[model samples]
Target: MAEAVAAGRAASRGVPGRSASGRSRHARILAALVALSALVYAASSLLRLRAFQASTYDLVIFDQALRSYSRFGAPVAMVKGVHNGFGPDFSVLGDHFSPILAVLAPLYWLHDGPETLLVAQAVLFALAAVPVWRYAARRFGPVSAHLVAGAYALSWPIAEALAFDFHEVAFVPLLSALLVERYDAGRRVQAALAAAGLLMVKEDMGLLLVGFGFFLLARRGERRAGAAYAAAGIAATWASSRVLISLFGGDNDYYWAYGSLGDGMADAAVRVLTHPWILPGAVGSPPVKLLTMALLVVPLLLLPLRSPLALAALPLLAERMLADRFPNWWEPGYHYNAFIVAILVMAAVDGAYRLRGRRPPAALTRLRPVAALRRSRPVAALRRMRPWRALRRHLPAAALLAGAVVTVPFFAFGDLADPGLYRPDGRDRAAGAAVAAVPDGALVETANNLGPALSARTRVLLWDREPRGAPWVVADIGRHTFPFTTLEEQRHRVARLINEGYRPVFRQAGYIVLTRESAAPR
Candidate 1:
């Protein structure tokens, strides 16, 4: 009986029982992670619903793009010339990076409303935490992995990015996961394909690919694979830029005034160098700034010392910071660095765990005595040793920590709060309703200010251009100045429409709708 028991103990260690049970445990943990991810997504969706009240300029661009896509079936690149006549001709290439539009196209078909798109975006951003968590867990132990994931999901930059509808930032988790997978597989072609996909998503994604590739070469000494990755990354970057130029080159109004190519390149370099310094100001309020700074810095300091992963995040972070300088200095609108920030935090946590020690628990030491007893009296040894029992003791604390980190942020600030009335509320609702009331195939002209509202129904036409068989001409009565700031310019545009035989059909606060007369006066 003793010998039989000893054989059973050895058999358990050989594979079947231990390996199968471990896999089952892992699956259960992953399921719990998925459930947590779903909850976070739901919370983000609710917040987005409440926040998308005010009509922003970007919304107008997206609305127009969607309307044009609905009408023309053209990709974003082909729709460069259809500006609302404000400042620059809006290009889909400028806003809807290919990957983002790819995701949004399906949502557009499902809901066909900007509000629905916003909700979908929030959910996508929230679900990004899953890949991040998995990556962290694979690199670090469960304790540190949960901490890294929690920090990323609840980070202030991510929160702000979600609040604003910047799709560029949403690609971070996907990019991180792709890099990790490519590194592990040692497949240059797959890595290149992933890099290409990211480049098409956003021009800045090239920087991430470069940084990641460089880190792989520098640390792993996988020079051949790294060279291929870098080469592919550069090629992909060039291709995306060429595509954008080809799409928008013919339109004189599509010029980017940020800077010349050389100057822009130089400015981009400077922005990356100054990014960490600007973190304090980007959060706006001092308290939030300090807290944010602490969170960012702490993880960075913890990044595994001199590891390639630590260095890989630098270029991407720098590039995002540099890009932010061209349009504005440290503004929330350009908070694309949130992706790199989360990655940096993960690296820091991974570094911290590695620095401390990578060792299994000491209860495994009891296995020696148990093995000795097993050779003599296997039944007694089984009673004396319980490896599963020791493992179970540590699992609860790790799970509890993960749960607390994920849950605390949700309870504290996850609810939909009023971000003031500028979202998709009263005015947006009224505008959408008014646009829906208009008949299809209507030519709409609005004061520049009402473009977001007017865009909801049909495309706008300037007075110089004849209505392209459109039945309704909705005119904006707000204002037009340097940045469409004066009401008089709006009045002038309105007067021009009236002179052109378009009659006012509907008037609301700060807006007026005009339709073409059935009979033109001779």
Candidate 2:
């Protein structure tokens, strides 16, 4: 492996003006991937929106929160409990304290719908390719950099996340990629801001930041900065659960997820720590953990394992592995992976590059694209470091393991082949019309899947919840709404609206809209 790297190194060095040519090639690859990734994700998400694939659970949370911000109201989820759990009229901040959503809130004033959230999510996720491409370019040559960028952008986990719905997690990849880029570039202020942006995406990200800070301190020699990062992350995590979310969301504070361990966050922590011997058991036995590792790392070729930067992902991995939440915590192609995917990819690039004990040469910094990296201490130091023969010895194993992934079936691909997932039809149009008939800020009850369409309103009750105070209700009587019971049950429930003085405002296409008799007309 060293001989191969040495030969490749010599070829690039022997040619006149080769370095400049290589930097130009890297620039083109980065530019192409960034553009292609953004376009595909944005177009696909928009198509999903036009179809009926987008759901209420997450899309509504993001849209309603943004609506509140745009309208200068408190961040209330109009569609809370429709597809997931939360109190009606609940502030989204109370749930996750993601103040960062406020940054894009103004867009709702110009356009109001779930599509806005979808577009924003797509853009954010695709923008992650920018940093990933740059990092890969620095790690590998301009030629191999293309392959890394392709994998980073087209990873099943990332595609699955984009196809699912709008999540604060969509922001995770962008922020994480930026974190690694700025940190490696030695742009302290930019890196710190990137880290801060990550915590604003979700409370759990604070713990991951603590791990990141530890890696920087232990591996990169940035003592003071690392200490500050660790302290900030620890404080933010404590505040997110204990102070911010607790004061806003109540004592539950999302600790219900760890019900098997204890009652709440405090109890769970105490239980885990006090029983030191239970650490092994916490990960659900050795074999299961090994399987989980393969699921995560195999797709990426296990490149993350070759670097100390892998430690940045440890806290998040531990968090997911120890959870008993619907087998979702262990899944590879889901929203949970959004938190660690970008970090792992960046780590993988570093790992692969470190195999030869080389870093981006200072000459590469002369290029406009990498001019941000003005410092070259990493390269200077690595030039003096000894060869990593251990990594060389394992190259064959890594190559063989990476080769197996090529044989996996397209069925193992991230997205489904269902036509309904990508096309709009009568039911979708009917649902939208029903939601549109209701006035803005009107109190309405709706099906689980349809809730996000009306999420811009200030009042909405989920299908499972009793429609006690709702002044208006919309139901797709002929169809089944997800995360709820049968269509027959929904039709029966809608039939009962007559006893509550609700008169039909509009009825067509298996959709029925109703309002209380004593209320205003449609």
Of the candidates shown, which would achieve the greatest lDDT relative to the real structure?
2
Tens digits of per-residue lDDT, candidate 1, 405-440, equal 553344323444434433565555555555555665
Model 1 deviation from the true structure expressed as Cα RMSD, one decimal place: 11.3
> In each prediction, how many residue pairs overlap at the backbone (N, C-alpha, C within less than 3 A)?
22, 0
Q: How accurate is candidate 1 locally (lDDT)?
A: 0.49
Kindly report the root-mean-square deviation of model 2 from the true structure over all alpha carbons.
11.0
For model 2, the stretches where C-alpha displacement exceeds 4 angstroms are 1-25, 81-89, 220-225, 249-252, 285-293, 356-426, 429-442, 456-460, 477-492, 503-511, 517-522
True lDDT of residue 34, candidate 2: 62
* lDDT, candidate 2, 349-405, per-residue tens: 777766654555867867875774344667555545666443444443345234333
Which 10 residues in a row give candidate 1 its minimum summed lDDT? Answer: 7-16
Pairs in clash, predicted candidate 2: none
State how far residue 152 of model 1 sits from its true place (Å).
2.4
